[model samples]
Target: MKQGQHKQTDPDPAAHVSAGSLQGYKGLTPALLTKLAKLGISNMQGLLLHMPLRYVDETRITAVRDLRSGEQAQVQGEVVHVEVQYRPRKVLICRLNDQSGQLVLRFLHFYPSQLASLKEGKQIRALGEVRSGFFGWEMVHPQYRVVGDETEVATALTPVYPTTAGLSQAVIRKWIAWALSHADLSDTLPASVSQSLNLPSFAQSLACLHHPAPEADLASLESREHPAWQRLAFEELLAQQLSMRRHYARRKHQGAPALKPSKTLITALLKSLPFALTQAQQKVALEIGRDLEKPYPMQRLLQGDVGSGKTIVAAMAAMQAIEQGWQAAIMAPTEILAEQHYQKMQGWLAPLGIQVAWLAGSQGKKQRREMLAAIADGQAQLVIGTHALFQEQVVFQRLALAIVDEQHRFGVQQRLSLRQKGGQPHQLMMSATPIPRTLSMSYFADLDVSVIDELPPGRTPIVTRLISDARRDEVLERVQDACMQGRQAYWVCPLIEESEALQLQTVTDTYETLQQSFPHLKVGLVHGRMKPAEKQTVMAAFSAGETQLLVATTVIEVGVDVPNASLMVIEHAERMGLSQLHQLRGRVGRGAAKSSCILLYQDGKLSEMARARLKTIYESTDGFVIAQADLAQRGPGEFMGIRQSGVPMLKIADLERDHELLEAARELAERWLETEPVLVDKHLARWLGHAEELVKV
Candidate 1:
């Protein structure tokens, strides 16, 4: 066999057992298999699904004389001269001659084997950008291959695949080609559905994407917008949608405690609140109420912008469960957030004669035991805690509802564990950081989503400003002025302690400096490194108005409600993510008083992305818009904090770019589920290797 070529073999009968089974592949060592596994390629289907990262257009080779400077060109030539020279640097130069002209191939670093392969009279094909070097026309470190004959030159666009260490692109391409030739390429989608959507067959799409014709649209292929690309992207998205629909169907079959909407507690709690619920909140509350009343388990996602009153909506849902003689639990990601929820819930529910209990990792043995007993005995009508609530010792008498705050921070397994505490409980997952529509459709498809689109009445919009740290004294004067007026303020530092490497302001150092600068005002410090107790104490002081200025880190970004704090100064805001900056800005503006947020950054030191993030934060207060921009800038994986392991790894579909296809696929999946439910298993088995595991999200 020639290099980068694989012989076509007959399809193995056992290949039908597993779509991409590697059992039939020959000459693969255990070490190579291990490396391939690390790249998530275990079988023939896996290899086929690994799409090319890019394509090299070598369909028509350009002669040396026809090559233009700054243009990528490929040429077939015979090596005429080869030498190693040490002038300004040690370099190897090989001269090649074609029918029309001669060109020079220069390599700053070359192995002995490479030098040996470039001996005189050897025929080679080189592809690279032509540059005007010291020689007439030179290509530095071009991709070159030894050719047995002129016919071996490529006649189609060459695929460049993503490979792991110890694996070459050629090897991956060869294996993928082999798999393509031998593996079954049967149509997974129904003929009626494909025809309605104007989609090509699976085999046709894969062939076009992996090996396009010489006249294929290079731009379309590169941008992943060609008809063939769309066909594959749609199929991948449909597979995911099918998996989600299946999971949803399975959950719908499970029985859950049908909690009644007891208006007694809900009415009492609402009457006690100083403000009335917003229209959006009322609408979502009704949705949640309806979901809780269903016999089947409710899997719902509640998304609201920061300070959008999600907690009140959650509290209302919990009250319904409590009124129905069942326990309710709320789980938060961090201890601080859990404590905040505990305090808020206690204040709200205690007046209604409903007992609210708190459990945290920081609790002592006696307190933890008491809390656990309260939960198990149903004495604690509503339980609020962190991951400690998921521990084996913590059991609920009848957990009718589980409210998870900051849902993205917790994985699917943690949510499952909490649900398992009792008969499948109606889960209400809350996220203050609004997700883009594309993400919500693909990642949260299994759950019904309700968004709180309106802010409460009498809430003031936060005025955001972008200023340089060079104006530090000006910012400090503003803070002092606000503090003098009896208004609390927050000065957030990105770092807890000053590091010589970063040179950014630290929480501790800023606290000391602010104390020294304004000797009359009290200042408190809080950071992640501080003990839970200490952090809570400092936070309490700030919330109680005992501290006029609080120096802290991002720990105070979420669930810290202080209406009196009208000023927010985020130092080194450029270092923060878009959603995070929005959250920090949300800390203020909760009161009716006019609030201002000052984003402090070092002058002229921001990267393009950082600059764009700060600009977006300054220009927009809409969380959904900010989230969309963040997704576009940082991608879904980083924006969601690497929790993508639970979601399907989409090979071709782009959440940002291919949102239309996602919607189409989702609608199609729903239709198929309603019409041909039996075929879902067969479709998923063909497209998704482990449909059960992939649908857990």
Candidate 2:
């Protein structure tokens, strides 16, 4: 072998046996066990499933002259000088030379043993990115070891595992090698299913991924686009689908009130509205109406664009349940939104002999007690509130329908707790934030989906404008013009209290500035810090056209529908997310007047991500297109909040890249579940060990 080449061996023959526990190995200590436990590696299978974050190519050695700046390479050379300096900072510098060139190695932090090993005149191998330093080519904090006569280089790429502070890469590699030799690496999927999908065997894929040969496609391995990676990703996605399906089946076994569709309240409510329901709304209302008639629990997600009229659909669903003598509850993520629902529903239902009760965290003890009593006595035919609806003290006599608005903003546990208030109550989740197709296939595979794809008639499309903060004076003039024209406007800011670190405009400051600039017009302010009554008062004035210009934070993002608010000017729009910007823009365009949204971004301060978000929002107003772009940019983890919730995040799958695999897995899981019960059980056991948390939500 010239260099960086060695003999290879076939994968161990223990592949037919299943993986065993970590305790089966000898020479285990308490300290090592604690570390392994912390990493969640209690068995040999856990070690194999712990994939590498990235791979380092240490399979080749380049000559010193061939080292390129900004490229990583390993070089063998003799150290000619070694010194420790203490000037601007304590440092150790070594000069190494080969026949082609001299290389400098600098370490800001070093060990005494490393100094002894890297003495002058010692031949060593160093691997790191080469960069241009003051002293020609250099590498900082490179991995270096003394060269010995019997030393052999690696013929395969090296893996950098996700490790804890105490667990070293060497220890993990040693344990994995042992497991590869002793544990069974059999395929979990059946032969027919695996062959139908054209996926590789589990044992072969694992071996190839862990020890990829030098000739293996380096780019594919690093980006996880290789077939070996795809095979594992498919298995992981299949596991997730199976888990969700199983929970969905369990829900199907439970009994619900079976509130048949009643037209008594539905007809009255529809006739009372000033406008008729859109075709899309009527269609989704029928879908929800039928779901309410099923004995099994209904878990449906009603999604639509902003101002698409989801609240009315939810109200229709609640009316059906109430007409069938079952109470309904609606929960919102914020006090502002919850109060909005309470007021609107009370207006529509109170005259129809329906008692709509209100509950919120900010309510006084006496008010809360009265609300709770009404709910317990079943006197509150329709209950609307914030997260207080799920609080333990607020008991519901008969809550058959549970509606959650802006559902994605809530954690899984909060939603689950509300459902537990009534035995197997039908759930109707509404969101203005559209879920992309890939996410609908993966994260929300279990639920039935109904999309109100059309906006009600007379609602004008919003004309989005991206303007630099340097032109903010023009935007202010536009806001003043719109307000003077007998229409309302919203000026949204990112922060409420002063944040010097961010140094962006705050709501109070903007409110004061607008008041000073336009003395004749009313410039009211509302933020999360305001008391609920104060916010309600300010918002009521704005909704009634008393406040011409409202300076607020994102608290007005969802469910604050003002038909006359025809203009929205968001300050520091670069600091907001795409969904948030879209929602804020939705605050306008609810009325027939031609609406516009001005995004005031600091041009010089815009990052590439902020620029992309603003460009996407400015170019298109379609929620689905914007949702796709947002998903592609932020990914499903941050986009759907899989990392912070009760759902189990995928171990080896990227929803963006492995969407095809997700589709395949979903189909296969459904088919296998219908026919191959034993095989499904075996595969789920292999993938989801003690994953009770996935369904607890």
Highest-scoring model, TM-score? 1
Summarize candidate 2's per-residue lDDT along 1-697 as a digit string, tens digits.
1122222333344444354455634544567767888887776678888787777888888988888999999988899999999999999999999879999999999878778888787888899999999989999998877787567888888877888876777677666776667666778787786788777799888887887887888788879988889999999899889888878878888899998778699899988999999999999999999989999999999999999999989999999999989999999999889989988998888889999999998889999899999999999999999888878888899989999888887888889999999978999988898899888888887788999999999988899999999998899899889988899899999998788888887888898999999999988999999999899999999988899999999999999989999999999999998988999999999989999999999879989999999999999999989988888888888885667667767778988899889999999888887888887777776777666328634
lDDT of 1 by residue, 85-121 (tens): 9998999999999989899999999888888788899
Question: How many Å off is the CA of 462 in candidate 2?
Answer: 0.7
Candidate 1 lands at a TM-score of 0.95
RMSD of each: 2.6, 4.0
Clashing residue pairs in candidate 1 are 20-43, 20-44, 20-45
Clashes of each: 3, 1
Off by over 4 Å in 1: 1-20, 497-502, 642-645, 693-697
Report how far off residue 694 is in candidate 2 (Å).
Answer: 1.7
Q: Which stretches of candidate 2 lie over 4 Å from their true place?
A: 1-43, 65-70, 86-90, 97-102, 121-123, 131-137
lDDT of 1: 0.86
C-alpha lDDT score of every prediction, in listed order: 0.86, 0.86
* Model 2 TM-score, 2 decimals: 0.93
